[model samples]
Target: MIRFVFAALLSVAAATAQAEVDIQEVTSPGGINAWLVEDHEIPFLALEIRIEGGASLDLAGKRGAANLMTGLLEEGSGEMDARAFQTAREGLAASFGFDNYDDSFSVSARVLTENRDEALALLRAALIDPTFDDDAVERVRAQVLSIIASDEKNPNRIAGAAFDAAAFGDHPYGSSLNGTAESVAALTRDDLITAHRNVLTRDRVYVGAVGDITAQELGVVLDDLLGDLPQSDAPLPEDVPFGLAGGVTVVPFETPQSVAYFGHQGLKRDDEDFFAAYILNTILGGGSFESRLMTEVREKRGLTYGVYTYLVPKDHAEMVIGSVASGNDRIGEAIAVIRDEWARIASDGVTADELSAAKTYLTGAYPLRFDGNAPIADILVGMQMTGLPPDYVINRNDYVNAVTLDEINRVAGELLRPDDLHFVVVGQPAGVENTN
Candidate 1:
């Protein structure tokens, strides 16, 4: 009876939901603010801290500094080495993690209600006082550099690097998050300390928690984790202004297979036409097996095992990327099919059925993203980080439903440019000639 009642309540909540999510904002004694969603359905609590100014803020000379700092946070901290810290958390069956993206670095924890106290203590230590010991720094640096060096030999990496360089010349977002081998080699403990000081701010940080914790308790956790961090009066860096030279950029490699990447720019997250663009992308390349690209390029012709496209919106700009992996012998055929499909979508708009199916798939797939507390917490933090209204998730389906076929067609014609398509191929083609 209780479960049934909760389900009914959730349905009501979903129907009337708006940007004002059912979240409570709590202020800790130490003055840190936290946004929380309380759910007693599970015995665990998930806490996330999104600190503004991630890898994109990597100082001109120090490309990968912020990324390394994120990794060192949990490697050791507050009177404990990495192993000791791992053991302490394992004893309580709690999970602690750290990650960095182009926009922010995040520290997360999931712990049972019974072990909240221990989890809080460890979480605070990792955030407040990291021990970037000399040996630990050297070890991590060596390992990271070794991997970057290995990538230098991989054709796929070569193609991607070349494409980004050509597409967005000097944009910081174009740089690799995993710094170059030389850059990682030059990093020292002081660089990590500087990154933490400059970017980690209580004001710039947002807190999110879900599962077994109440608003008040989660507020306390945020205070403990971030209260003492430096405060920032400035906002995150504005989006990068990126311009593309849309043409073929081929990085000749010795391998027998060719990897093709093509497309141009698109809209950012907060763009008014996001839903329209998203639904249109599903019909073009993003909807997997049901997409026109998949059907034409893979399922029907078998030119490649997998082929797809997507819109990757950055703070300043966005890019439409399409890719295919195929044999060198059929490289010409593969590129021809990709370009033909691209032009078809732009010139000849999708059918009513295609548009309808795309919208249905997108609307139906919305709730699958919130299956668990951790996923929900991640989405909440991401939306918050991107300056989206809190009710964005709850109101998503409505916006998706509001997309008209005309709106999608307009975006398709505006965004997809086969004539301006920048093609990049990374492997040697046995019989395929380079037409362009």
Candidate 2:
């Protein structure tokens, strides 16, 4: 009966999650801070850590260094080889995930209360003392190269690459964090070592822990896990403007279906009108079937299977982006429909019925996201990264509900730009041509 109650607690945790989440701001003896949601009902816990300056920390020539470093984090640490590391993690019956993005690096861990210390020790080793062995480096490098190769042939990847290149030019956002085959293949162990130091520094880390942990215990754990990491000396990249102009950028590829990525500059995460924009987008293109884009593009004309849009407020830049895929023969028509809808929404805005529907769906569906401790921990870290207060969980739905019809329409009129909306279509379509 060591930790047999964990399964039962999971059910109670689910109910607790679906109702309310109480967050505690924790500060370690060493000055590190983490958000905590103590659920002693469970003998399980999830820890999530997000570090700023992820792949963007890669030095000028080392595009994929941070990504490769993140991949190798669990491959081995200190004296352990890949196989030994795997065996240790498996023996503890724990789970860990590491990922790198343009804006952030994330580490996620799940373990029983009994094994939390050992699992965190494993995590700390990966973060702080990774060996980055030569064999492991080559093995992971090959995988990166294979991904690059695959991306080259993927229409979606090609479209995204083209769009980013056009929008951000030489900014880190312009290229894939996966790096080019040439760049990834050329990365050395020294590059990874430097990347680890640059990306995992103490100053840029945000953490969230949930279940079977207290503030007192988490403070000590935080100090042990993160206090050893050095302060980052690498400066964050400068913000870049959205560089693409309005129009279709047709990339000629041999595929029956054309995939397109379209967007223009968008509002930042902290913009006062952000909640209004959030509601506006749902009515316009973000709410799946009922969104205007889908209704116009798919339900009415049957031009494409799906079409949607979202506000991508990255740390350094912001964008309103959308995508659609359709047969090469029908893609031009789909683009035309999308453009028309874009213009229509920009000018006329949305009806009252639409706004109410969006608000209901948005507010009603949010609680479902907190299905378990891991998800709650993720949301906690995400809130921290976005500079939201601890009470944001309780207040977020209110923000959505409080948005007025006039406010959302006003935001829609200002935010939606028919003139600046652009499309990067990848396929050999009959009528579309490169306008970039």
- For each candidate in turn, the TM-score is 0.90, 0.97
TM-score of 1: 0.90
* Candidate 2 RMSD computed on C-alpha atoms after optimal superposition onto the true structure: 1.7
Report the C-alpha lDDT of model 2 over 65-124, residue by residue, as the tens digit. Answer: 999999998889998999999999887877889999999999998888888899899989
Residue lDDT tens for model 1, 1-436: 4334434534443343223246666778887766677878556777777887777677767878888887787788978998888888777777778887777778787777777798778878888898988877887777678778888888778777777777666665777778888788887778888877766777778777777887777766767667788886435655654455555656778887898877687778888888888888898889469898889988889888888888888766688887888988887788888889889989887888988887788778777776566666777787777777767777888898888878888888987888777778888865444445
lDDT of each: 0.76, 0.90
Q: Model 1, residue 300: displacement in angstroms?
A: 2.0
Off by over 4 Å in 2: 1-16
Per-residue lDDT value at 58 in model 2: 87
Tell me how far the alpha carbon of residue 434 in candidate 2 is from the true structure, in angstroms, after superposition. 1.8
